[model samples]
Target: MDPLGALQEPLFTVLETPVSWTEVLGFGSGALCVWLVARQHLANWAVGIANNLLFILLFTDAGLYADAGLQIVFIALACFGWWSWTHGGGPADRLPVRRTARHEWAWLLAAGAAGCAGLTLLLDRATDSTVPQWDALTTVLSLMATYGQCRKLVESWWIWIAADLVYIPLYAYKELYLTSLLYVGFLALCAAGLRSWRRDLVARIAVTA
Candidate 1:
């Protein structure tokens, strides 16, 4: 038997859609990666690298080309995040979490909007993407969130939550039930992360004061 044959074999069926082993694996790793990140664990980046690769395959196979491309970007960001988390805190040993400032939020919002518009036009004209608008919105916002996460900014969770809300419905429409479910799990994890990071920020402020 060809080893690649199993890639298409359904591990189960959900809502008349075949849920493949690849999607299952992607969902599992994604959930674990998000949970670990919520706890501020250094290991999250390594797991996230694996998740990004798996998602790249899954989204590409599903014809979600924009998302597939986003995963490629995610892999690069994950690598940068791994290094930053390990060594980017000066002499503090770990990067401290901080709330995003108003000026930084303004820049991020503007960049996200511009990126979404550009990607939407590109995907609409250049690709056969099914849901270009929602896809582009999530992809650009996710890029911002990942960058914020790398810098240990507490507001990254807010961006992730916004992206996840859009992703859940979009994936469900695409019949990527497992990936949709993963986004649901991600919403819960984002909540946990926001709270955890907020506490960390509070303590840091107390210490500096």
Candidate 2:
């Protein structure tokens, strides 16, 4: 059986749009992963890994090569995040939400700009991608956000919000409506995550003081 065959099976329909089982599954796992992360639960990484795998299949079928490729990097980052959250903590042995330093923000912004430019050029030249700029921007922002998340930075949620806003329209234009809706949900969840993490950061700082 083909690896992508399962992704082709229709789970439902939305306004004449066929929603695949893979997209439904991806939607569930992706929402769960973000929710868990908002609650500061370690299992978000594992759920995120499953979500990444599902999206790899979904995006590949949609001809979204950049997004499909991004899932691979997300998988690797998820693994590192899983381990880091468990061991790369303070004396409490659990990661705590913290503010991103100014210097780190500068580095992250520069890297995001550079990555988006390079990936957009590559996709434009190497693939038949029509929305290369949007794809590359979302992909690069996601990478920076994931890295920030691994460090338990409160700013990660902001980056996620930015990526989700771009992803929603991009997925819809690609005819992946369900995935687009998923990003809509992601946008709301990112706000919740930002609020939750900010609260945690404030509490941690108060304790330190």
Candidate 3:
């Protein structure tokens, strides 16, 4: 009868796995958040923030400190993305999807490399994370994808796809099977997002042409 313990208690059994409230809510909110993002809806940020909070609790309980910490970062990024979509649109005040620039790609790649290296070292030294390298890799990819999404860069979907691929196996190894299944859904949503965003970008280009 502790409150936190009650919250973490099993909601039901999924394939003999005790599914908790955090995982179930995280799964639902995560799916909705990504679906909204794929549809270019502003509410995705709000839903995504809620999902991050739940994952923070879920990851911490699972001893995935790196992912737990990443959820905090995700909250901040979601706020910035919210403001960006509302205010960063030039003149029209409506952000439109665009392609990543050549120079921007170089910087993003460099950031990914440095972030992965630094986070891997920190997680390996500071925490008992068994999958530090893979965790760090996915963390960096998620960061890149979030930044790209905030900027409305169509390439964000590619980065998301890469992260989802890593996340599926990583979560499965961590015994977070529900979260693993969620990432499988994310992979499909990301493909749809890529196709949709690319269509928007092409339409914009044609309008200017």
Candidate 4:
């Protein structure tokens, strides 16, 4: 079982049909959202917010509560990122495509870890969650990544790359093959976004110098 083909084995079937309207539209909006993010276009937020709404409907029906909840968060984050990109730096427009500050990194890590653990415990205890642990982790990690993106941090892309890599397989296990393949494609785009954003950061720094 090769890594690339790893999603094919023991394919699942809770929601059997593929290429439904919800999923097909999801694919289109999802791909556009990523493309806009890769270019660091602020308009990505608009597409992202729409994608989140679409996925919220889809994931809720599919019984992926965490994924659905994460989409809700993405809505807020998308609006936030849009505003931050437009304004709200420290006193000026000096906050274009920068690395995360040391203070921000510490809080980000602490918040992400605590959030994941807490969500896992709560879900495991309260909800009829099938994979409470994994779902919680993905939610928390995705929150961290979305926050990074909101700030235009180059590290955001790397964060997404890591999560989506795992997400690809997880979706496969749940037998959302086309969606799984979408995550695989997302992983590649995230890598590209990392490189592209790094270059933009360097250029921004040079100009400031």
From the highest lDDT down, the ranking of the candidates is 3, 2, 1, 4
Candidate 2 has its poorest 10 consecutive residues by lDDT at: 1-10
* Candidate 1 vs 4: which has more TM-score: 1
Q: Which regions of candidate 2 deviate over 4 angstroms?
A: 1-3
Local accuracy of candidate 3 as per-residue lDDT tens digits, 1-209: 78667768999876788889889989999999999999989999999999999998999999888889999999999999999988876547878899899999999999899999999999999998898999899989999999999989999999999999999989988888899999999999999999999998898899889
Score residue 25 of candidate 3 by CA lDDT.
89
Question: Of the candidates shown, which would achieve the greatest lDDT relative to the real structure?
Answer: 3
Once model 3 is optimally superposed onto the true structure by TM-score, how far is the C-alpha of residue 160 displaced, in angstroms?
Answer: 0.4
Write model 4 residue lDDT over 20-132, tens digit each, in one string.
45565676788888889888777788988887877776676666788888898889888888888878564365347888889998998999889988999988887787878
Error of 1 at 20 (Å): 0.6
What residue runs in model 1 are displaced by over 4 Å at the alpha carbon?
1-5
Candidate 1 to truth, TM: 0.95
Instruction: Evaluate model 3: give its TM-score.
Output: 0.96
Q: Tell me which of candidates 1 and 2 scores higher on TM-score.
A: 2
**C-alpha lDDT (0 to 100) for residue 177 of candidate 2:** 92
- Backbone clash pairs for candidate 1 read none
Which of candidates 1 and 2 reaches a greater lDDT?
Answer: 2
User: What is the clash tally of candidate 1?
Assistant: 0
Question: What are the root-mean-square deviations of the candidates from the true structure over C-alphas?
Answer: 1.3, 1.2, 1.2, 7.2
**Which one wins by lDDT: 3 or 4?**
3
